[model samples]
Target: MSAVDVYLADQRAAIPGPSWTRRDLLREAGDHLEDATDAYTAAGYTPTEAEALALRDFGSVDDIAPGFRDTVAIGAARRTAVLLVLVMLPQAFLWDGGIELGASAHSAAPDSGLFHVLDIIIGYVGTAGAIGALVALAVTAIGQRWLRIGRRTARLTAAWSLATAMIVPIIGFTMLTLTGGLTVLLALSALAFMAAPFALVALSAQRTLAAC
Candidate 1:
């Protein structure tokens, strides 16, 4: 049998409940495995057969959550992604024309005093992005070697980071649709998109630690 096939077979046996079946394992684990294929490269384990081996080592579905509980545990993921977005919301407004909320602060002319707030906001965003990236990577590292998390959550976090990065430009443009780029609604949505990854990382890391 191919390594993936072997994984599928073992997943059925590994799961604690009888309701779990091969089809469910493939649906969840297959996607999770595909996302994790590059993990070994990150881990300094460059086995020519690393992808196959990783599939073979993938832990049980129950280890992650019940087979039927696919979306059930994702509440934590959502919260985690949100926190990461919050980290940089202020910076996002500063870089975008978002602060032009129809007030003196939004004036086109340069204001001596207000410039300080802009600098501070930008600095916080810079620091938050760097720190969040580092913490996410560390969690991902621990997640890969230890299936205690099934590491799928880490991939969700990775994909969230990539997707959130893509969202920044979209949000900047979307702000143009409104009267002021930084109207309250636009600001909230922008921040929501930006902080998505941190929510997944925070929740998964929490779950992984709790598993201990």
Candidate 2:
């Protein structure tokens, strides 16, 4: 294949977008290659040499495509963030369930210090995770110009934060159940059922960001 054809294909594979946008980008890239080839040919280079020189002057697909890919990543991250929040919203109503369970577990024994501590740990950790995820997702939506963080960093932070947020409460409640509190049985059952949804969303978000 010709040098321009190869470069265009590489660029298209490296950076994804709408069909019309990709076509427009490829068109612009083709024009640049043609102009560069003409300049090299006019400078007395052979056709083959001119094409090679044109491609070299245009820059590698790896280098040229990253900017476009980063832009695409931002958009992908934004959509994923919204989906993550939507999935997690139902879990909010379930928060009081954990609190009630923990409180009941605390009342089961004269020395329920560990249960209290675990309850506090769950609250603090969950809050931190939620905040971190939201901030990371917001940074992604705002783009690099506003946040100055890379797309990968933002994505990783958001994904891990969400995972932590989803899993910590369940762990805390499960531990509370060990304190001889039968009331927490219902809470534990509820959390067990919710685990699948949490894992599904977390894994999906991680894979999506890693692809980005």
Candidate 3:
């Protein structure tokens, strides 16, 4: 394309956009490319504001940095954060069973079709809340450089992970007819994951903010 479009894309990439103006990216890129010609403009890039953003989007930096450590960190952190979400995949079904059990224990006739779906919804909501809190924590930690927050969040997530790790024991216990502890282990898992959710929300917003 022309100089204007190249600069515009660079600027857009830097600031972020499902919507943005030429002026916004221009401002975000430090407005340096305003005077350059298009062909040479997109060329000779050396990790300027725009380049950093493009790099963040996964452009190759083979000869640029010693290694793509930042990018790798970005991918891992994002995926792990996503994994927190994936961890709850079966929660809905499990929770639905819980609801159905509760209803049956009380009286099956009172339970409506809606309750089955609502049971899953309740479980998924809990899982979502925990995940959301974690994202919020990550954004505050990573973007703001909170001295202790990142470490704290990492620890908490580890705890959550460890709690879930005990699930194997629960199933093993069931196999061995010793399942009482399953409830306790699951409670621990829920607690650890629920300890932080707002942080995860922040993390989810990080990419959009950094671009701007």
Candidate 4:
């Protein structure tokens, strides 16, 4: 391959993040390099010389990769934030269903204080988590455009997402177990409907943290 091609390959190897963002960065860089090469050739430089000049003008991968990495990291963070919001937004309804089921179960039980306490805790924690997810979304989206938000904010957001993802499932399963209605089918269904999406958010958030 040509020197410019080698440089791009090296850049691709150096950066790590979301595939789409990485592809976009490489595509735009390649387009710019092509344009620069063409301009140098029009000035009567040889093909090899034009390629060299274009590569030099484009700057070394080491020099450019940090900025590109930052962009990719931010993109990953935004995705995590969006996922968190999507997952959390529907949680109220899910919690309500769980609460109703728990209420019926608790009504027939001899002692119901633990279920009541767990129910209240879930409601408060879920609301707080939802609000936090919204704030993260806003910071990564709107704040990113208008403010100076960057990796620190992204890291914080990722941490918040991971924490919420972990906390929600633990409390949910505890409540489910306490209700004494937990069955294999119900457990599997909860894992599929509730834990799966939360697991996705957690994975995305973890990736975002690593990228940042």
Candidate 5:
């Protein structure tokens, strides 16, 4: 391979992100290098000499990788934020449905103290999580235009997302089970609606943390 090719390979090795992101970055860098090489070749430089000059101007992997990694982290953070909002916002409906079903199924049963306590806890925790996710989404999307946020902020957002993902679902499941109305259908619904989406958010948050 040519020097430019070698340099690009080194850059690819140094950067970590989703496949699409990595492809775009590498493609842009390659195009730039090709343009630079063509310009130098037109000025009477040999292919090797032009490649050398182009690579020199492009900067080394170590010099540029940190900036690229930061970009990846920010993108991951934005994705995680979006997923969190999407997953958490509609959860109230699911919770309501679950509670209604449980109540109807156990209309003659006395209310358990633990159930009441869990209901309150789930209410407060779920609300807090939804609000926090919305704020994270807003900051990453809109506030970013006016402010500078770094990897640390992205990592923190990911941490919060992961925590909320874990807490809300577990409590919701626990509360439903306490109602003595957890049927196979209800269990499947909870898994599909709550567990699945939260799992997705958790995965995205993990990716964001790794990127950051």
Candidate 6:
């Protein structure tokens, strides 16, 4: 490969992004390198010597790529966080004892000791998972360095938190449905709502991981 081609390839190896994104970034980098090489060649240097000097002045891949990669990662994390908030906020209003079974809201069966116990258990589990997931998203939005967290550790922690955030609500609501407090229509609606967060987060995670 030509020196410019080789240099661009090395840069591509260091950077992590979608194909189009990487192409755009590398094109800008190649333009700078070409401009530097042309300037050196006009000063009487051989093509090879000019290319070498241009690369030397351009900075190493290790020196530049991490910052760019981290920027991309942080942007993805923010988008994911925004999505989670959008999905969860409306659902929070539904978590009250009064569930909508049809056009109107209906309270759960009164004086059911089993329902009370289930509500208490589900409340604790769901709250813990929800809070953990929010904290993880907040940390990711700010970046790992803010809390001295490593990249791998951050990804793993976020993945786990996201999974729990999705699963807990589904479990809690599904159990409520099993108690026969709602009609089939409402139970299905609840299931659909609970599953959305998990599905969306999984897809977001896949995209983020592929970029990384």
Q: In model 2, which runs have C-alpha deviations exceeding 4 angstroms?
A: 1-9, 12-59, 97-111, 143-145, 162-170, 179-193
Top candidate (TM-score): 5
User: How would you encode candidate 2's per-residue C-alpha lDDT over 31-101 as one tens digit per residue?
Assistant: 98999999999999998999998888778887788766665555555555665565455554554555454
lDDT tens readout by residue for model 3, 45-72 = 5335444444344333233222222332
Model 3 scores worst on lDDT over the 10 consecutive residues at: 171-180
In candidate 5, stretches whose alpha carbon ends up further than 4 angstroms from where it belongs are: 97-110
Model 5: number of backbone collisions: 0
Q: Ten residues in a row with the worst lDDT in model 6?
A: 97-106
Q: On a 0 to 100 scale, what is the lDDT of residue 19 in model 6?
A: 56
The root-mean-square deviation over C-alpha atoms between each candidate and the true structure, in angstroms, is 13.2, 7.0, 13.5, 2.6, 2.4, 4.4
Poorest stretch of ten by lDDT in candidate 2: 101-110
The models' CA-based lDDT, in order, is: 0.47, 0.64, 0.39, 0.82, 0.82, 0.65
Cα-based lDDT at residue 139, candidate 3: 59
In candidate 1, how many Å is residue 180 off?
Answer: 12
Tens digit of per-residue lDDT, candidate 6, span 34-108: 999999999999999999999889887888687656555555555555566566555546665245443343435
**What is the Cα-based lDDT of residue 201 in candidate 1?**
42
TM-score of each: 0.29, 0.56, 0.29, 0.87, 0.88, 0.64
- Tell me the TM-score of model 2: 0.56
Per-residue lDDT tens digits for candidate 4, residues 1-212, read 98888988999998887678889999999999999999999999998999999999889988999888888887888888889889888777654655444354442332578877877887787888888888887877777678877677778888988998988888888878876777676677678767999999999998888777
